[model samples]
Target: MIYCGLILFIAASIVHLAFCALKRNKAADATKVFLMPLLALTSALALAPRLPESRTAFVCTLCALGFGCIGDVLLLSVSEKRFMAGALSFFAGHIFWIVQYVFSPNGTSAYAWGGRMFFFIALICFICYGIVLASTYVLLGKPKGVMGGGVIAYGGILCALNFTAINAVVSGINGKAALFYLAGSILFFISDGVLSYTVFKKDIPYSRFIIMLTYITAQALLAAGCVLPYG
Candidate 1:
């Protein structure tokens, strides 16, 4: 039943992405916006049972799915304020991930790589921030509805989430949990990479099809990450 739901989760996301790509029509976006949450909920249902009944894992799973749902809502929103709210929501989600790791049975393992993890996360934020700031000159010139600063902040937060998940996995905090999270992080990175390439580098021909494919893959993997594996 759980595996079936996973397959469905992926299928639904694919459909949502296809809907987004095939038509920029308002109806398409509306359909996708609604479907995203449903997909997330289903994914959560698929994975949550795998976790140990411990409060830590349970709470972590809730936060993962909750933040994922909030993120979906934020992306669907047309308003920047709403989007900012969403970024914050996901930021909180990342915090949950941090807590999940801190409370894992492998607490000692977390310490082994804690310093290295923080350093890398900080490095990523600094670099991504610098790049975004430099590009603001161009973004500001355009009618890009979102403030350049807000855009940078959103990217920074997402990067933070990625790092949080990466750290959770790499730190040996939780083996199965880490595996799920790392997979999600990889997909998210790929999605962002495609988006960055499409947005910043115009030389490459952009396809909504590719964007949807990666986006769906990212979201699906993220939902899978929330499964809260016990062993």
Candidate 2:
């Protein structure tokens, strides 16, 4: 069932990308709506057999994917209001991921690494924040007003998520899962960056193609990461 769901997701992504290439906006939007749910279903199928043992991770993964679906739908509109709502939904999703990683057994193991590990985590976060700050200034120029403040807040959370994923890797709590989380988080950040460039700056040629490609793949990997440790 899990593999079946993944296969469906891949098929949907391919169709969506083809529509994007052909400039079929309506078809692409239709396909985009299914992407996250399929991924959620995939993870749900994988986690179901584990039942209560996987309860916390299961709930967190679903909530993250649920918000992702809402964001996907809301972002289909061009309205700034819709966009802000979508961004907020994704922000909530990231928070869910942070909570999952922090409380999960794999994340809990990092405490034994003590001060040195925390120092490294803090350093990585600092570097990520610096990168985000520089990128915002260079690429998007200075943000203004409510949207600007929202962007900054979102960037901070994103950096924290990336560093947390990196900490999971450094902790070596669950090797494959940690790698998946780190890769997914980095790709998710990149996708958002590309999206911001397209929105606030000039649109890149085929910007939607690039954005959705990375976004879907990042979601898939994150879902897989959520399931792998328990599986």
Candidate 3:
């Protein structure tokens, strides 16, 4: 079932990207709507056998992916209101991902030595994220209102998600899963950065294709991280 869902997801993603490249908005959006749900379905099926034991993680994973699906649909609109709503949905999704990591049996239990190393690495990464966030906010013309606050808040949560993902890796609770989580989080961050720059700064070549490509891949990796067995 998981493999079936994954194959469908890849097919949808390819179709969506092709439509995006061809500048077919309607076709692209039609395909885009299924991307997250397919990934969520894949994760759900993967976690099914582990049920009872993985109840919390399963719930969190589904909720996160559910919110991603909502965001995907909401973002299809051209209105600012819808865009903000979509951002909020995605923000909620990030929170759920963070919560999943916090509660997972194989999450966030760093060894003393690894904890210290992670602390330093996290500090540097957070600093870098901060700079990028600030710069992007400025590039967006320093939006002065709810949108401004929302952007800052969203960026902060994204940083937290990335931070938590890195901790998962250094904790050594589940090496393969943690690495997938870390990579997914990083790609997600990059996707958002590219998206914001394209929308608020200036048009980038093949921006839509680039955004959806990274976004869907990130979601797939994150789903994989959640469903893969812990070591």
Candidate 4:
């Protein structure tokens, strides 16, 4: 049953991407509505029986995926506020991820590795990544203000998520979960970056495929990450 669900999830996601590439707005919009929900359901199905680190852990992961679902719908919306609303949703979702990580015993494993060095490295990387993003926004004529602040905050959370996820892997605790989560977060980062570029800057060739490819893969993998058996 779960495999069937995953298959359906993949099929539907591809259909959504196809519609997007075909420029069929309505079809694409309709398909987009189902993508995240399918992922959420699939995640639950895969993870529910695994005896996750804790019930709260699974629940938090579900909440994060659900938030992404909300973001997906709003982002598809045509209104001016849709993008901001979607960004907020995703930002909150990332927070959920951080919450889950912090609550889990293995979540802090990254901090244990290499002592303060990892922390300093993560801080530096975060600042550098933010600088590049700030430059991109400025070049796009989206200067520092309300939008800028939101972008920075969101980016920081996302970077933190990736950093912790990668740390989860390095700590050698629950390698499967850490690996999947890390891969998904990286792809998620790419997806959002591409999405912002598509929205704020000039369109890139094959942008639709690139964005959906990364987006769907990110969600699917993150959901999978949450369900993997904990150490």
Point out where model 1 deviates above 4 Å.
24-27, 34-54, 106-109, 113-146, 173-180, 186-211, 226-228
Clashes of 4: 0
Using lDDT as the measure, name the better of candidate 1 and candidate 3. Answer: 3
Q: What tens-digit string does per-residue lDDT give for candidate 4 at 168-206?
A: 776665667778888998998899888877777778987
In TM-score terms, candidate 4 sits at 0.88
Ranking by TM-score: 2, 3, 4, 1
Segments in model 3 whose C-alpha atoms lie over 4 Å from true places: 109-115
lDDT of 3 at 143: 79
- For all predicted structures, in order, the TM-scores are 0.64, 0.95, 0.93, 0.88
Candidate 1 lDDT by residue in tens digits, 48-69: 5654554564566567657856
Q: List the residue pairs that clash in candidate 2.
A: none
Ranking by lDDT: 2, 3, 4, 1
**Model 4 ranges with Cα > 4 A deviation:** 51-53, 109-114
The C-alpha local distance difference test score for the whole of candidate 3 amounts to: 0.84
Consecutive 10-residue window with the lowest summed lDDT within model 3: 106-115
Candidate RMSDs in Å, in order, are 4.8, 1.5, 1.9, 2.4
